[model samples]
Target: MKQICVFILVLALTSCEYFNAKKTTPEAILNEELQTFNWNDVDVYPTFSECDSIETKNGKTTCFTEVLTTHILEKLQKDSIVVTQDVTDTINLKFQVSETGILSLLNIDTDSLIMKEIPNIEALIYSSLDSLPKVFPAIKRGQQVKTEFELPVIIQAN
Candidate 1:
């Protein structure tokens, strides 16, 4: 009877371990967690200095846009770049805001006509962006993350 009881106890212990064992490897679990994370959405959007007073999401977004637009327009006016011929086009500016609130230009998309008319247009845009105050980068899962923005700049010359 003593031997039978010992054997039963051993079996019970082994079974418990088997039941509690992990079915998936650690790497697999990590991959699953990463896959579940949504890349498109962030917990908090990037903010500019003028947008600090805004409380609502929509209000902040509008303020940010307005501040950036005003900065760019002011810079362009200061440069006084002349277009030989009347032209109207939209320039697409792509930039990334780093976790430390630094803005880096990624790319600028403009038609050939605009490029020819304003050879230093790219430099002007970069200077305008750099002149703005630092921005708080977007936050994801309670951590700051790099975020990208694509802004359309319309240029109309008469």
Candidate 2:
């Protein structure tokens, strides 16, 4: 009877250990959370005030791009920064729009010649962006989110 009781006790303890084993570790939990987060795309694109009336996604995006480009070109034209030589290059501008509709310049990639000709190019771009109306930030999973954009501005000197 003593041996049988001991065997039963061991079996019960082993069963409990198997049932109570840790199924999820901290690392596994973190990985699962990361998988659930969306990092590739947003639910909606950022928009300018003028684009608010637009209903379609493509239309809004087009309007935003057009308005920003127009504003930048107009500002540059007003500044009268003359390009001494005939050159063709593109300025790559990267910026972020915060959830509160504020614009933040991230980086600017342009030709060294352009930079040399227009030493205050960054200032001009920032000023132009400042003049723009507030923008509705991108949306992700029903929440407003900060978004980044890379715009290529083609510069052709005649």
Candidate 3:
């Protein structure tokens, strides 16, 4: 009886969390996962309806960029911008797509010469986005998330 009692006590003590076991709760596990999650990366990049047909990841990004560039180029082409001294520059546009699929421009970086040549360039770019194809928010861990992008657009005029 003494030996059985000692054995049982040892088993119980070792099994208790104070000795060895640390029970993992759902909340704890979730918190741990959140801490390790990469917020900057997404499983699926944000895209437009026009790019929905693309099956590959790279294809989707390319299509998204092409569609956006085409829209902006079309808008700029209509303005008949005239520049002297063969102006050539690149506009680095930074923007965000909200989790709700709404787009907002954060900033536009361009040469001062380009700004002077195309006085309404910023407004034109903003306005062009107004009519872009429907946007879908990026997907991360099966949840829609906001994403930011920096796209470069070249400006050239003779």
Candidate 4:
């Protein structure tokens, strides 16, 4: 009984150190070297909804779906990249936001009559990413979620 009590006491004391050693310090987590994304001026339309909420970690804000769509559309228009086709638009982009608030492309689909200028269309998406806002609420529970951003790039002559 005495030996059991001694062993338990020693285990308890050593366990603290073990846990501490395994834990990562806040500084280690916040250091620029450890960060994956660098936030810049990305134009994102932020929508506040039950599904959308702001996450303020490391002094940064992430926007959600509808707002992101609006922001992207605005970006495309600002660049004057008009779609020179009068057809059905079917383009979808699926990507993930890194911990540091950078977009990492997961999938892109460009299969539609509307996409005549494939290369330019792609460029528009990439260019707009800089101003793209982060998804809000930070995808609870799951490590990843599927979010789609669709656009119909149409060009009309004056």
Candidate 5:
């Protein structure tokens, strides 16, 4: 019918105009500038095991350790009810630091909450790690290297 034909034509024109009116702004264009450098691009320590080169003094720890732990705790607390509940039990996250200075969270000890909030645990780990500075040194062949460590974060309800 003629009415059906007209309806199809109007829809085609409307869709064309709708798509044409959409424009990317300058900020979006600038954000796409691939040359912009980020720490991830040039990060030396690529993983937790790669952090073996990072020397840990007996009393002197890296300045970033405390700050990074605090950030991770904050993120977990925000997203995890278990963390906020002040549970006396602890959950251990085992990970390896690659040579690239990136800590790969391999496994999480499943507490009641961790099993319940699987997505939150994954997001909290990634979000907290985004702000950490990468500066892992390389390990020597003869020297004993320690690239992996544990952080027992306490979950307390306030």
Candidate 6:
């Protein structure tokens, strides 16, 4: 019994160094991971209910783009826009999707000529997106995160 006790004490003393080693905090690990991570890409793209069924990233992205473009076009058509002069412009629409799936416009880059032709283009785009269906926020690292996306909308008039 005495020999056994002495052996156990020696083992415990040697193992003390293992317990005293520095421990990393959760914040430190997260900061390091975030530093090395690519923020431009997401594990899963934001999805509309109609797009949730799609499994591939590109599929979901295509669906989302189609739905968004269709909605915007529909809104523009509903306005019965009639341009006096031929206008062709590609508007870069920048928007952010919240972690909770809400979408909001950040900026709209349109040619002055297009804006002059369709004065209410901004409002139309805003209303169309405001009425969009519920969205599922983008996923990053298994957590829902806000994401910004830019879509180019082409406007042409004869």
lDDT of each: 0.84, 0.84, 0.88, 0.52, 0.55, 0.89
- Where is model 6 more than 4 Å wrong at Cα? 1-28
* Candidate 6 structure quality by residue, lDDT tens digits, 1-158: 99999999999999898889698999999999989999899999988899978989999999998888888878777777788999888999998999999888999999999889889889888988867888889999999999999999988776
Badly placed stretches (over 4 Å) of model 4 are 1-63, 82-84, 134-158
Output the number of the lDDT-best candidate.
6
User: How many residue pairs collide in each prediction?
Assistant: 0, 0, 0, 5, 23, 0
Which runs in model 3 stand beyond 4 Å of their true positions?
1-21, 25-27
TM-score, model 3 to reference:
0.83
| Error at 114, model 4, angstroms | 3.5
Q: Please say which candidate is ahead in lDDT: 3 or 6.
A: 6
What lDDT tens digits, residue by residue, belong to model 4 across residues 1-158? 99999999999998898667576777887795536543332333222343334444322333344455666667767765445554345467776664344555566677644355444767777777776544442332333333333333333312
Q: What is the lDDT of residue 110 in candidate 4?
A: 74
Which number leads on TM-score?
Answer: 3
Candidate 6: C-alpha lDDT: 0.89
Quote model 6's TM-score. Answer: 0.80
Ordered by TM-score, highest first, the candidates read: 3, 6, 1, 2, 5, 4
Residues 1-87 of candidate 1 have per-residue lDDT tens digits of: 999999999999888976785678899989999999899877777888778888887787677667777888788878888889997
Give the per-residue lDDT digits (tens) of candidate 2, residues 1-158.
Answer: 99999999999988986777567899999999989987968877898878888898888878988888888888777877777787678999998999987878899998898888777888888898878877889988898999999888887666
Q: Over the full model, what C-alpha lDDT does candidate 1 score relative to the true structure?
A: 0.84
Query: On residues 73-137, what C-alpha lDDT tens digit does candidate 3 reach at each position?
Result: 88888877767668788999998999999988999998999888888899989988888878899
Which pairs clash in the backbone of model 3?
A: none
